[model samples]
Target: MSEEKNEITLKNYQVKIQDGLLQHLAEFIKPLWQPKKIAVITDDNVGPLYVDKVEAQLIEMGHRVVILTVPAGETSKSWEQVQVLIDSLAQNNFVRSDGIVALGGGVVGDLAGFVASIYMRGISLIQIPTSLLAQVDSSVGGKTAIDLNAGKNMVGSFYQPNLVLIDPSTIQTLPKRMLVEGYGEIVKCAALVGGSFWEIVQKVHQPADIILQAESLIHASIAFKASVVMRDEKENGLRKLLNFGHTLGHALELIEDGQLMHGEAVAVGMAYITAAFEKKGMTAAGTTAEITARLAQVGLPLVANQLGSAAFYRAMLHDKKIKGDQIILVYIKKIGEPAFYPLKITELKKWFEPILNSQIEDN
Candidate 1:
């Protein structure tokens, strides 16, 4: 097949999706940025794999490239790591005119994007998301964040990147588990939008099947997200829909304490919440079964059994979605239709207790 070329124009920047764009990195960067110094922030896992090639492209463009690699994983998305990167930038003299390139999965994107936002009160950022999860979800949105003791993505900013380059070939290096982890987000997106995207996602019978459809899937995902972000860049209204499973997902991720990857936690969250709401007659009948089947097809866990309802609830109390005393819960009336229900903090447990309790009992 001829290499797919798709571009999404958001409110502030552009997202270019192609199969081999990474090989022509300089061509893309040349149009949006002319910075003399560019800090390429990535994780150790990704650095060893792609940093040299990325640096070569940057160097070819006559840009001073600084490779800042941090430990790979969620733990790296912390205040101390942020400080470490800031010091590195300062020590190397990264001025306001210089740009930052986030070159890994979600953690690296979130951490480096946050640093780019605050250093010198904000600098240009370019997101070169490697992992499937990052390319499909985190990289497109421009919602950068770091985790806190309280919850995931608790500390961060709404900093848009000047450009986003997604090369699906990078996903070839991801392990099976990592690819499945990414499907959690892809499934979440499909669940929210529904229709053909949802249909396409459900057709995948195995993890490797996703690779066959990566470029098209990435394009569809980015297009849907870009449409949402263009309307509600600050997530004040329309963009809130994107938090479909994130509320409980973040809590489950926190309570699991790294045992659960972000996408897996989201899979469990989506399953539980859909089932719970369906039982209460709030969601469309059979929606839970459909979602559960899809999640199972990809080997995503449907239940987080280690923690009880109280612990999960406590973690959720710190979620960014909680507005004052009410938390907005996103659910579907049926496939292709999603609605948000705002529940008071005091009544949040009523929504999750039955499903969680049953899960505990089963375990």
Candidate 2:
């Protein structure tokens, strides 16, 4: 079959998804932002595998390339790392015309994209997302951010990339856990986009198999995201639906302190929140059980009692989604659709206690 290509046109630019597109980096970027200089920011784990290949290709095409690598994992998304990256960019004599290429997972994509958004006020950003999570979600939206000690993505901006290149073949290099983490996001997308996509997801139980079967799923997920983002680029409206499991997910991640990957945390959030919503009569009957089973089949944690419900609730108060007295919560109406429900901060513990306490029953 021919390579899959998708173009998502926003008011400013487009997102392109194609298999093995990274090999043609030169040609792919030539039409977007033909830069004299490019800063390829990646993490240590990914740098050894793909960054050099990208650098060599860019050099062969006669463009100046600078490769910068930070320690891998979620910690790299801190404000301190962002400062270090900025200082490095300045020290390298990078100018406004130079572009940034985010070549890792969501962490690198968020950090590098945030850097590009602020450097010289703004510059071109080309996302060559390697990880499945980055490829399917973070890389497409242009919502760049760094974490503060207070919360995940405490600081962020809605900066769109000039172009996004999704190369599904790159996912083959990911670790099993990483792939499973990506599956968490994929499950989120499938649950939100229901229809043929959900049907396709129902058959697979392993993350490794997704690479072999990702062609249509990746395209569909990105297409769905693009449509939502195009309608609400700043996330002031419809885009919030995409946060289905993210509210409590972010809280669990913060409470766990790097033990939980983004996808894993979101998986728990999906299950617990679905249960909570069902209990409140907000979601359809059995929605919780359906989501919990899907998440459990993928080996995701379904309970958050590891940190205790009180602490989890405390951590949640730090989420940026909180608005004064009420926080915006995203809940699934069914497998393919989602709706937002804002809840008072004071009532969070009452709602979250049973789900967090489920861990005791599970044990």
Candidate 3:
């Protein structure tokens, strides 16, 4: 409600953050795309809340709308689900000219986006990210994927959406835990950028504070990611910085078996890696403590003390960032100044040994 509406233009698409964008879905889609059919992919949880309204708007426009609902959770991001969605699209007689509307959280966005990318060798994609996690991070980036047993986002594509429509008001429906899940990514963005954004984020003492400032915070997070995506669409160089906590975060996610939310896992990854790198003289002094304090302020976990170091290492080996014998890790020289360091796979265990051991001893 702060601004009511704001727009950020990216290279291939535009992100529209509006207070009641959901009600105006048809108005927005008319200008961008006019497919014969629009497949609205969502989850059971969100379908009951928003899909009927979305379908009604699309139908009012004389466009055929199909509602495909998956179960609500990370498990929905799988090959099985992907195939199910793909079959749904095909069975509905979807074609290259048809479009897809991903109408839920990150899981829905990624799964539906992946389907949109491959169905008929790619169709139009419009992302309507309802959750904070999707609005701030995943929805804008165009990175679509389904998890493999080996790792997160193992099977995916850099398929950008034609438009990203964010409704901040929808976040009011999210539970406190889901809202905090989003802060993980928002804090990650602030730590990476290290300017006014970081200052604004640092002052937030709790999840309620973020909700009060949701509009501005969501816009800032999306704008930062849009800039990075524009500069490095393929994540070739500078874009790698966006993976700040993702390397070990994905590993921790795999180890916990979905016990941790993506943002929570990444929060722990960012804290632990920064601490380890600071000890090795790779990160700036106090950077670890600063990042830790900010994460804790938002109620994000700082470490997975119960998990062992070896499990993380094994999981990290499957990381996409691994090239040859080294895996690229992003570290903060300080808040707002992020740098990438590619540590040899052989040396990874040695680097994290003390931190892992101490965590076990403390337990």
Candidate 4:
């Protein structure tokens, strides 16, 4: 098949998505930034699979490249890892003119992006997101962050990248579970934007099919995210809608520790929150059933009971979305229509009783 090149222009930069983009890394990098050094931050999981090829490509173009690999998974997204990266950069003398490349999944993107944002106040960043989750969602927006002991993405910045390069071909080697986690983000994006994309998601099943059709889905998601980020780059308004299932989803992820993947938790969050939104007349009457059924069909979780409702609620109190006593929440009116609702944090437990009650029973 022919290659697909899709562009998303933001206020400060652009996201370029295409097949076979990785092979031409030098061509893409030269215009974005010409530097004495390039720090490629990736993970052990991804580094072994794809880093050598990427490193060779950069070196062939006569660019000096530094490769740094962290352990794979969420645990790597921490202050400790950030310090390790900073020390390495300092020792290697990464200056303002130099650029950092995020060459892994969301964990690497967020960690490296945060490193780019804070090192010497700020530096140019090029995101080469490999996993499906990072390609469709995290890589495009400049929402760089590292999780704290208290919450996910609690300490970070709204630092946008100089360029985002996505190659859907990288996902061919991803584990089945990781790809399903990516589908969660894809479904979340479709629910938010709703149209032909939503229709496409409803019919997709099997991993091989998703990989075959990855480019289109990822391109559509980046386009939607880029539009929102361009309008509200700092997430003051329209950007908040992107948190549709994330509020509760984040809480569950923290509580479950490593058991629940981000997408799986959010799938449960979407299902649970949609039910609550329906009960409150905030969402379409059948929104919950429709959303949950589709997610279930795709094998994402509809309930999280590993830590029970009370613990989940307690964890949510520490979420970044909680502003003092009030928490900012995104609610769905239906597919393609989402709105923000601020509620007192103390009232969250009572307001989401039905969803929480179900989790209580499951626990």
- Which regions of candidate 3 deviate over 4 angstroms? 1-5, 358-363
Q: Candidate 2 regions off by >4 Å? A: 1-5, 358-363
- lDDT accuracy of residue 274 in candidate 2: 85
Question: Which pairs clash inside model 4?
Answer: none
For candidate 3, which ten residues in a row score worst on lDDT? 354-363
Lowest summed lDDT over 10 consecutive residues: which window, candidate 4? 354-363
Give lDDT tens digits, candidate 3, residues 271-355. Answer: 8778788878877887877877777877788778444556777888998888999999998988998998989999988888876
Instruction: Give lDDT tens digits, candidate 1, residues 1-363.
Output: 112348888877888888889999977899878748999999999999999999999999889999999999989989999999999999999899998999999999999999999999998899999999999989977888998777778889999999999999999999888998998888888888898999888778788889998987788778888888888888899898888888888888888888899889888888877877888898888888888788888788888765445788788888777889998998888777889988898987876777777751111
Q: After superposition, which runs of candidate 1 have C-alpha atoms over 4 Å from their true positions?
A: 1-5, 359-363
lDDT of 2 by residue, 152-218 (tens): 8888788989888888888888887887788788889889988998887777766556777777667
Model 1, 16: alpha-carbon shift in Å? 0.9
TM-scores for all candidates: the values are 0.95, 0.93, 0.95, 0.94
Decoy 4 TM-score against native:
0.94
Error of 1 at 48 (Å): 0.7
- For model 4, the superposed segments whose C-alpha errors exceed 4 Å read 1-5, 358-363
How many residue pairs clash in each candidate at the backbone level? 0, 1, 1, 0
Q: How would the candidate models be sorted by lDDT, starting from the highest?
A: 3, 1, 4, 2
> Candidate 1, 354: how far from true, in Å?
2.1
lDDT of 4 at 194: 89
- Model 1 has an lDDT value of 0.86
Deviation of model 3 at 2, angstroms = 20
